[model samples]
Target: MSDELQHLKAAMESMRGELDAMKAALSRLSRVVCIDKDDDGVETVHIECTDLLVRPWSDPRHLGVHIGSSEEGSYIKLYYHGEEHAAKPAISLAMHADGEPHIQLRGKDWKARTDICIQKDHGVVAVLGTNEARGAVMRAQPGGGSVAVLHPDGQARAVLVHSEQHQFPGSETARPSTDLIFANASHDTQMKLHTDDAGSLMMVGMAGHSDGVAVTMRKDGPAIIMRGVEDASSIHLMAAKDMARVAVNQGWLAGDKAAASLAAGGFGSSIELNECDGTKRVDISAMKDSASVQLLDAAGNDSVSLSHISGSHSSLAMRGVAEHDCIRIIANKDAALMRVTGPQDNDTDITSAVYEGKPHVLVRGRNRPLVMAGEAEHGGVVCAYGLKEVTGGVASLAGGPVSGVVSVSSQDGTPLMTLDGTDHGGRLLINNDLGLQRVVLGTKDEAGFLALNNTGSNGVIACATPEGGVVSVCDPDGNVIHTMPRLKDDDDDDD
Candidate 1:
């Protein structure tokens, strides 16, 4: 499609023969001495002043194979037809000073090459190449049928007939390049799989399209994730198959910082979701002993919580958003509790709890003593009003005088009985369901007194100085039904 693509395509195609051709070229180059002219020319009938075997081409004495003698050594040399002929040898096989056979091909600066060689260790090697260094080289060892292909850089790009039993040798031993392509004899590309320099898979597919899809790795490993632009939304899914670990993280455009993330493998799994604030989160994870689901507030406080342990252990709780572990439901292997709180402020609540081998349901309000509706172990339903907690309710009837100033009100919230503040003794008034005062018992003038009333009348019978222990029971007509008077002085204890 473009110049770069064209180059890449060409490069890929060239790679197919790069190895084989290289080895063939080197094999030819190394076999350079076997020139056609070496065995050509006519031989002399007898030894004479003029050396024998001359090629009768171009000139009479020119281009002849001769036996020469010098103070240095007796060797055979080939000469070209020139003014200074016989000064160099096109091919020479001679004896070294060490008495070992030595061989040389081609004179200095002569650009001639051949393709066969016989040598030590490698018995015979055929080198194939073109120029001085012979680009595209191949060296074949006849003894082992081993052939090496070298790149221009002299690096062995490929080698065949490895010593390992002539097996395929495995591609794993192939130093494959991300750009390397292996094609059929026709050089038609069928596949190219590669990984980037960072070792992240650049691609894995056919015909350079890599499974008909192009891939790019960013940052890390073989994990596939589909993320929206700018990471505003994403779905992450990965599994470490070896460890059986699976994880997922997904978010929506309409959700909080974290919409949902689940990571659960054999060891454990957890999912978090719907966090309004970064801190407002719900997390459910498994533990070796139990599993817990906790919903926390912005302050990292658990406002709603639930936990269950394998062996008889479970709990559920709701608390002030600012507090933690203010349980609504906390249980053990056998039982649990539940609590409901005011939607806001967390001031009023109702709870059912198991305490000290008993179960209690407590109704509580803001700045008000709790009302407990429970049953004693051997008793029936017991109801009382006082301080109550998950542990249990206070052991008192109407609660002491400090709590004595309770209010009983009508359906309209009008006080039927108003008993106000009693840190030092307050009034206790009883009223009808219509909020009309029916009886009042309290301290007036620093003396204890009790007043009785009817539906429309006030003070039907009154105990003026109840400090002396006296009571007046009233009738509906506003008359004293009976009176119990103090028989003794104000000795207080002398009843």
Candidate 2:
């Protein structure tokens, strides 16, 4: 009787172990079959449990369903809601390269709405979702937690998205290095721009509380964008290396260069170039409001090309043909120009330009029609143009308001140095070699002071300086032609 009982117990234990093994095998054999209503037949996929599911690419209205082993299946649908029948679904989804999920939505309509949610831990990528009835509307909300998207193509289109909250800052980022575009949306009464890297690029706030949208990039940055943000009101582009360093803001035909130091609203004024190194130039022909052009030279003569354009404003264009050359121009209203060539040497191009609503400007030339503004630390401005052009004890200055007296002196000035605040006069002091020096000011030229050697023979102006005991004159070939002593007497001409 005891042996029979033991045999019965062993048999039961063996059966239980077999059941457990069967359950594990069933779990590992699971797969998701992605089928599109537009497909020729039911396209099924047998995959590992860890692999992500993909919805067959199709129109926004096209439905894609996911079925898991031993569990119920879920379906994704598209919709639309906008004023003037403009609110429509322009939503699409896809799997990010990182194995996460993403959604692409465009608010092509004035006021539209849509929603997207993940019932599981899987990721998603949506390219475009448009309401078949309306032209093109991007409105949707992702109810799930934090997720990222990469939209290399959409970032070049400026497609609008409507969402409760998104994570894309258009400035300080590089995306879809391809055609122009990215992501635009209204959220919490402010319009926000989206990029591959969340908050790296952005657009100015639009009016009203509309759900915002998002945009992203694949892996690499694109090269040229034809009509990026063509439909948005204001768009901002920033460098990836330094989000706050260099940025360009443009919308409705106005362009602004910005630095990290300049306040948001303050950037609309003149440009502020603090610490930087390079050459800057501009051409007003391509600008929408180009009117007049001018050029300013400290000591040397400059050659410039001028033309008249028919826009509400005037513009100046320039090219950086030489290293360490500064270009400054003043114009009235907003304008644009083209570039003819790139900069010479390893120096960067800088422009010190302003739009004063006048009829004339001091700018002309271009290497390319597009302008690139970097960070404030690298010396860039918005609504203000600045370039680098300081050589031999001279620095560029702005013609804006001034504060307490700030002074910068050369090593010897080949002369002594002193400041007469009461008299409004200043002197240059030189102590070392005269390669290239820049005396900068926080304000414009009217209240600024600079002393240097290469004003293009303009002679040191208002500022005062001491004479060097010995002077040497060199020709264009860098050959010393003459030398004179400071204390030689008039009767010492015994040669």
Candidate 3:
């Protein structure tokens, strides 16, 4: 009977070992399944009936973790579905309280408890808690110290050797390394460029894992080499030596080398030339900023220049000059010459002389200079809204249209052309004691060609145009009291 009992115990032990082996096989195939917590605070990872029968849990409070690598290692996990209120935190992999939660990590030679909290400090892309969090997740090195971190956002942020600075893999490093990230500005994730003992260059954009570019300066030379791959698997290259000449979208490739190029603009559809050598040349249409040129005359006098000349419009033309050289500016087919002498002094004098508003031309009160409106002489100041007032006329303002109220008075200061005067037959003439009222038009209407009249007859010389041909002086009503010859013939010209 004793022998029978021992044999039974051994059988039970064998069964236990087989069950453990089955569990290990199943866990290797497990994946993290997200289950939405329902209104009743229950999180459920629904599975097929056949799956449940193989690895059944007590009630619904089982949350599973496949604790090993997808390729190898034993599996260990505990699941909670909501069967017990106290088991909620374990199932959710979260702490119920407002403070930090500690998780114990066990390794071959050491055990450590790490506090979990949200990671902030990283710009828009990195938040707290996720691998992408700024300073959250860490991995233990084989020798026992935490050495590297993989951001939940999918970036291998940093890797350290002992207590030394972490070497983040990037284009600037040696070959066989990749330190890159992608981000949408709206997403709370980002790829950060790091700088050690210098400044970090940060780039953020919406792109795929492979849809980015990496540019690096050649260790021994001033040139830069850029490599990139698009999400569609297309590849491209850009080589440059400086930022000033070859801008990367918005940033200029920063360097002092004689040449630069950018492999950018969506799969490097374009190349840019910044500074080039003695025999190098680039097309003018491609230059947006001032390109540096090494112009070597037989005398070796270098003068950097632009490919195109700019001006104000048809009425204005831009000109340049060497020392003691004359700059000829042609305005509306009218050319004006200026001899530039010095640096700052020449620029100011030449600019003013060439572009100054031709005031008192095109009529004194005209808002724009005739030069601006296609006149040769007057075009200088046509668009010069800011004109100073000289003596003997209404002071000009910094700008015009000059539509606001104007106080036109006698030279002796008696109000003549005032806002109160009605426009009579388009003439602002008031029948003042001096017989001189005024009509005012906008600067554009400085020609003053419209008319006005007080047609309501009140008997004290009501307003009328000479064209009416009735010279009868009448009372308020239709009664004519006196008559005068028709002022003038219809064909009579005022001029």
Candidate 4:
């Protein structure tokens, strides 16, 4: 029994020594200082603490980076020496409630000046200025991004967006587009510049009224539009590869569709002015080798027209009540003519033309007398023709040796009577139906004489010589057979 007791005592002593060694090791491990060696044999020291602050030992107020934890989450705060309060940090990095990270930069007043945050949608957002009055915000997302500049009232003043798909402020459907928008203090859209798959556009307006100005560039061409109101006066300008046009609308109120327009294209160019009732009032046009100006009445009938065509005459025409009743003045390379036409086929024309290498004026009408006054073969002459035919009762004045003359013709154009001035004196003549002379009265050898003829050449004559009066009769062969106031040398004389 004594041997067993000695052995138990030795065992107890050995156990006590081991237990003391374990307690010492545990006490050393309980300290925060931890030292480790990595694969590269680099020694690293780690220390754990409830809070951390970095500052100059001589100035505790001048704190730099302070790291700590709160009931919410862990955070890191940055400070500047000139801060009024140590509790307000200039910068803060923290975890958001949605398990995302957020960073905030504060101003001297401890208000957040800027914030950079990761959103729950795995996007990034940055805001500038205090939370109460944000100045600007920039957001980037998986589908798109946006930058917005805000007014002091927190209304968006301008926004720039790039998106794979987006719904515009006033649009019903979403589309893929990039847009820059400007707004007024009232949150009204003032201007917008946008681009999409189809084209690009820029718009300007005021107080949410977007009809002020618009410019667009599309696949086909470009266009611009300006308006006073939504449905009021407007001007539109458009251009395509082959054509262009400008349109002006007075207003659409009161069911008025009146408009004016100017257009140009490969075919022609035209300007149209419309009346209040939408009737075409005036038209000016230029086409291939031709140009025209036309004035129209309320009924759309032509009132006046001026036109010029290459290789053709230029004309100014004024229309009357009837469609075919018009007066026209036309000028061409060959002549200039003025024509008056009626609804019937009746027309009157006055033309000044070059004929036979001489300028001439001709006045003619349908079924009316013709008057021709021009340079004639002898000299300047005036001719008048009767109705129904040019051969009836023609009269002419010639600037030749026989200056003044009057003539009468029968229906068949046979000379009937004539009174003319000769080189010597005045004369009168009468012709038969067969164009034969029947009577002649003239000054012969400075004496007044009258002669009458029959068909067989027999005639009677009476004359007043310088001395006295005389009478003579001629036989069929034109030989004088009787004479009054017989002469002394004549055998047949009766005294």
Candidate 5:
């Protein structure tokens, strides 16, 4: 019996050895459980399983980390293990089928609240969500970066971007720029602020349009534009090197289809009002030395104009249907003149001026006479010349402090008649074609005298002296040839 017992014991020992050897072999082959030491003396424990759950030693139903793999790929998840055992993870880091890495943070209810991922195209992307709806997304790529805030429905409400190569809406080329954009629920852009190589720009969208107002600051200057529903209707304000301008455009409206503009610059300032078809209706301009306002006809001819020049003149002109026919009133430091002109250079001019330190008025007509009234060496004088006819005459009236004169002349400028205030009283003289006096009437020593001369220098005279009236005829030598009612003394001596 002792021998039998020893045999059984030997078999038991052999079986135990075989079992231990199998265990070692399986351990080496499996890779499921391993404990290794590196050359640096660092120890590492590796465990392979369908799922790995790490929990607190003291409490198995608490927060823990879970690492697992599935058809969808490998993932590491952090979750809670309570009586209500969570079905979903609070946080997950996964390698998806797309060969990308992704991280997700979830709410208590297991709804994803945030996600960070690396994409093939975009270097990195982060999305923040609320109630399963994306609230915001940020993307960073080699070419650019952007942050977009979304509506609950996933439409982007606002976006900010910094791009190395950004292409604008209608441009084929790309540029580096930074931009901020706001959108409506429909994802239509409502407002945008952008900066590029050229400068900065801000645009506000209209109800149905993307650009209702645009303000820009460029390398050259700054500009602001506000648009209406119609593309052609707008208001523009701009400033350049040394100039500024504001223009209102109404090409959409009939009758007055063009733009009206007001501008000011180093040289001057101006305003232009336009008519339909882009014709100029009115223009007002001012310069350092001159200013003018013009009203234009439909054909852009000046219908009327008022202008002024510093140290020069102010003039107002009105044009007729024919551009050459016009009326002009001009005033200068020395004179104020009004001119009316017609086709063929026909003109009439009226002038009031200070001539030789005296105020004067002149009226003249093209191919006609000139009338001048003014303060002359005498008190006041009015002179008229007949310019229409070659043989026309001239007449003038003059007044002095104590005397006045009326003169008439022929076409050759020879005096035909003259009525003048003499030292005694008055004198009247009539001349012939040779400018020789033919008749004379005058006041002498308080009496009246009349005389008539012939071409031969013979003359007849009548005189009213204090005593009486007498008539005498004289030869060219001043000798009395005959006498009617001869002088009393002479008659007596002769008798």
Candidate 6:
């Protein structure tokens, strides 16, 4: 059993990684768009996209695009399934105070969501992001000018910025500067580089750099080397269409000095992956406090989910896999829960909850109750179940350490028998097909006795009283019809 559970956990974790990789392909915000329409019916016509597309920026020289709303005050925001005004945007493209452009990527806007900011300042651009609200700000700044990316927590990450422009000593003309920077989601710099007028390129690792690789280049590539600044080691790589090889402090060919490639980059605060067929078949993502992986069939028929929740909790579930919730597992807070279903046609399933706490288990089969077990405040509990007639009988037994009752019923819903651990002592009751109690043998609060009843609603045919062992025969109205006085020595035979 333990091995099985470990395998289950491993499978879940593996699927989670794949889902995270697949989330990059998932598309959230839709493409349907409406042209401009103000309260006065005056409109500014713009273009529409199926889902999302990048348009040309105002300045053709810039490689980026600026998306804006035709309605002057209206925001250009990515929406959920709701109306534009009814829902907050997950992403928004807006402007900086100085008329430069800025883009903000937000989560659900719930108290726990995160945001990413890409802003331009003084001819330079930076990317910033963060996790939960009031968390640290991930900063990536440029050499030209600074843009302060706000974090709810008011803390900033590490950053690096470097640049160098070349100019002739006697002339005012200056060549474009070579700029290099590595920043985290908080916009903090990790590594910075600047190429000198001599064409020498240099890079240095900053305080918070996760990847310690650095590039130091001379005039030509033959002598250039990208090394791990942290350990002073070189890296090597070989690329191809179908496969590639990579390593640190290694080489692919003889005399090929190690060098950094375009692949050198920082990981964002959040990563998403999805499948390309466009059905959103799989999605995987990860963040500081949580991770989510969603899976769907190729046709997008249904989904399964495996996720890590706030710190200590995790869950795995299948919805519509064979029928909604065909399987589910949850573990957290010193408790574990599990559920498994048999098939879609029949509602046969078993479930357990609070297994480490106050445990309970329920078993069922297609409108039929099989068995249920749990714990009561005073003691443990067990139940017997059945259908009206198909399964024969249904019964309930409940009690603590002191008292309890076990009652059984017939298939047609008629009471059959009942045994009671009563205050007067043990008691037995037998009911007829009409559900009327026709036989009762027990000790009452006063004394022990035996009773035989009639089929009438209120009838006692015979009774034996403990007082002097008096026996009476009664009519349906409960009137005594005969009496037998106890002899001096009468044997008590009660069954």
- Kindly report which residue stretches of model 2 are placed more than 4 angstroms away from their true locations once superposed: 1-204, 208-237, 242-495
- For residues 1-495, what per-residue lDDT tens digits would candidate 4 score against the true structure? 878888988888888888888888766655656888999999999877557889846576678889887767778898856445656688999875567778888877778888887665655554656554788888886578889998877889999989887776898887788999999888889899999988999999999585488999998899998877665787889999888999888773222567899999997999988877778888999999999999998887888999999998798988866666367787887677676665555556565655446667666778564777777666776667777564466666656566566676665668888788787788988888777898999985679888898984757889998778888888888788877876444664543
Candidate 4 lowest-lDDT run of ten: 486-495
Candidate 1: misplaced stretches above 4 Å?
Answer: 1-193, 196-222, 227-233, 241-259, 274-280, 296-301, 319-327, 341-349, 355-357, 363-369, 381-495
lDDT of 3 by residue, 313-425 (tens): 12212222344222323343233333223332333332223334332222212332211222232121232222343313122212212222334433333444533222221
Least well predicted 10-residue stretch by lDDT in candidate 3: 391-400
TM of each candidate vs. truth: 0.35, 0.15, 0.20, 0.73, 0.87, 0.37
Ranking by TM-score: 5, 4, 6, 1, 3, 2
Candidate 6, number of clashes? 30
Higher-TM-score candidate among 5 and 6? Answer: 5
Best by lDDT: 5
The deviation in Å at residue 234 for candidate 3 is 13
What's each prediction's clash count? 27, 132, 41, 0, 0, 30
**Per-residue lDDT over 112-178 for candidate 2, one digit per residue giving the tens place of the 0 to 100 score:** 2333334345332333334422222233335322222323332322444433344336755333311
lDDT of each: 0.54, 0.33, 0.34, 0.79, 0.83, 0.57
Which stretches of model 3 miss by more than 4 angstroms? 1-136, 140-192, 203-243, 247-280, 283-495
Which model, 4 or 5, shows the larger TM-score? Answer: 5
lDDT of model 3 at position 224: 26
Which of the two candidates, 2 or 4, achieves a greater lDDT against the reference?
4
> Superposing all C-alpha atoms, what RMSD in Å does each candidate have to the true structure?
23.6, 34.4, 29.0, 6.2, 3.4, 40.9
Off by over 4 Å in 5: 1-30, 38-50, 61-63, 81-87, 123-131, 169-173, 251-258, 320-327, 331-333, 340-345, 455-458, 489-495
Q: After superposition, how far is residue 211 of candidate 3 from its true place, in Å?
A: 7.3
**Global lDDT of model 3:** 0.34
- Which prediction has more favorable TM-score, 1 or 2? 1
